[model samples]
Target: MADLVAELAAAARNHTALARRVLSDLEAGCRSAPECELRDLIATSRTVPPARWNQLLPGARGIYPDACWPEARLVVEVDSRAFHGFGDAPERTERRRARYASMGWTVLPVALRRIRTEPEQVLAEIEAAYRAVLSRRD
Candidate 1:
């Protein structure tokens, strides 16, 4: 998908900047607007380490987290209301988090609304977790 966008950007005569920006976000593994916003926050944060979006974790039986610092074993899940609903959705999310936790990964779930309203606090928490994970390794 990113390669296709890059090709389009290369051939496009106009709006190449927009295409390039989209390509950059896609390459960074952003699947939604909220994820992109979180990525931007992490990118600009002083304390939080960079995250790899949607990467498969071998420790979690091939589960791909929303934003993960593989070396730190930390994951930040961007919870959007659009997808989460009544019934089994919440249960599934919890079970997923449990799987990551069982694998010794620190999982942080952040709502889409909070990402827009309290980005600073969110980043701070992520940074704190990142630091704690690294410290444990040391």
Candidate 2:
């Protein structure tokens, strides 16, 4: 059992490394936990999983969403205080979300603080956003 646990840990480390590398190449990468990756993996069967795309939102040019399910027209934005949570950053983000909404993208902005406090709710909202977009598509 110990050996199996060791192997699993090793595999997880390897996968996380690969995931981080891929995310690094993209514009909007998650600098937090493996939540973004988990969402991608978990979204497989139930919905179109998100991936690290250099250009996630078309016609937006420099805007790169953290993760997006293009088929569902959904985008996930993770906010970090260290990066975009100070000064006018919050306001800028609100404008960005508004712009994305104008483009008909259902944006889900989750704060790192909120994720730490209400993780389950954040996950539930993500799923709900997926369902909302999915229903809109149909």
111 in model 2: Cα distance from truth in Å? 1.4
Candidate 2 C-alpha lDDT tens digits along 7-112: 5556757447654444443324444454454444434434435555435487686788877777787887777786577899978888888899899888877776
Model 1 sits at a Cα RMSD from the real structure of 2.1
Q: In model 1, where do residues sit more than 4 Å from their true spots?
A: 6-14
Q: How close is candidate 1 to the true structure, as a TM-score?
A: 0.86
TM-score of each: 0.86, 0.63
Candidate 2, pairs of clashing residues: none
* TM-score, cand. 2: 0.63
Error of 1 at 91 (Å): 0.7
